[model samples]
Target: MKTLLIVDDEPRTRQGVKKTLEAWSAGRLRIETAASGVEALEWMEENPTHLIITDVRMPELGGLQMLERMSQAPTKPVVIVISGHAEFEYAHKALQLGVVEYLLKPLDKTKLIHSVEKALELEEDRLRIGRMEKLLDPKLLEAGQVEAKYGQHVRDAIAYIEGHLQDPIGMKQVADHLHMNASYFSVLFKEQTGMTFSDYLTRKRLQRAKELLAQTRMPIWEVAEKIGYQTAKYFIKVFKDSESVSPTQYRQQVSDPEETIK
Candidate 1:
């Protein structure tokens, strides 16, 4: 069962969140609460939690400061921030910090529940992927014989690309990491993955961007930056070239209830 930690100063808010999540979790989750950021941090350090839902304002340490401190922890727990302040600056900073969601106070029960559900789903997906990677690592290592001796190297390259897809990754950089010539590495990557390295990277980035677009109300520019495109124009051009539709159009289409139902 996954553990959830709720951090809020108000007793009413804390009880409200606990009751909501307990119901949403369907008795399959463990719930814990802390009255302030300091207490939350201490509890988190002492106990393992899969998700944290915290308020932006507290008596001692604010949510942003707590988030910054949590970033340095060995286990990176998923975080959702709720604030009464709807200032653009607060939302922007929360997004920049990679928070799963920045919700407004006087929380809508449905929205809050949905956000927690999504965060838990993402956590499960990540754990499953990690397990699959562990199982696949040995097979990849064994595949280097009778084919290309650099097969494992190519696999490493792909893993590296996946991990750093949200950052700038060029063919030359990948080749340098593998200590091989760019021309040879490019050929090897294509032969191994059945797609050009650049294509793979772009596809991965686009997939990630798509998920963010579907799940969050983040601006296109922020989404572009998160997926490693510095220029929103270029990002949109590439996305359109690949999907044959603009990002906004794609998002709208996916978000339409009738279209989704159909």
Candidate 2:
């Protein structure tokens, strides 16, 4: 079951919202509450929730500040901000912070339910896409489907990218090699690959890094350079951002068969 966190300085409001959501969701969601934004952040560090419904004004670390903190986290829950008429400005800032919904005080039960359901739907979609992307075969570049749809130049580009991954390969370089305009090649690449050229290159580099981490005992810095990253620090950052774990952590989890050699 998905978890939901309700944050408010007022104990009565917190419990009332929690109880109402529990009843409306009919136990489909596991609901929790925090008396202050500081307490909510502490809880989030230990437990991740699917959604957070927070009051704007609190004694310490109000809703907006909490969101700014959460943005730095590796994983963040969807947020719904609740504010009064006087806090309209705060609610507007929350919208800019990417709150799924901005709710005015004297909360309407129907509107709350609708917002909660919509957030859940969006979360489900996000999770579904993440799972699908993980399962997608990067090796599909060599498959016949690529050539059938994008014709030979795109296929050749993929082959070139795979062959020259250690080189400084850019869209313009690839386009020049293929005898096509860079702008046209970029658009065509995205249409056929369903991702921008830069994104595709990054994914390829990441995939190679994962393989090297899992199957070799190479120094992390060497692995980074081999995959076209200029520095281990930047490579580690990109790896953690994409995989939610550092390269050392990932390597520790996956046993390397060649680890015994050398």
Q: lDDT for model 1, on a 0 to 1 scale?
A: 0.80
**Predictions in order: lDDT:** 0.80, 0.82
| Candidate 2 lDDT tens digits, 137-242 | 4544544355666767888898899998888789999999999999999998988878888988888898888778766899999999999998999999999998
Clash-forming residue pairs, model 2? none
Candidate 2's displacement at residue 220, Å, is 31
Report the lDDT tens digits of candidate 1 across residue range 1-262.
6788999998999999999988877889899999999999888776777888999889999888888888766456678999988989878888887789999989999999899989988877665554333223232334334335446888789778778877888999989988999999988888776668787788778877777776678899999999999999999999899778888987776554223211
The alpha-carbon lDDT assigned to residue 131 of candidate 1 equals 35
* Clashing residue pairs, backbone N/CA/C < 3 A, model 1: none
Q: What lDDT does candidate 1 reach at residue 49?
A: 79
Q: How many backbone clashes does candidate 1 have?
A: 0
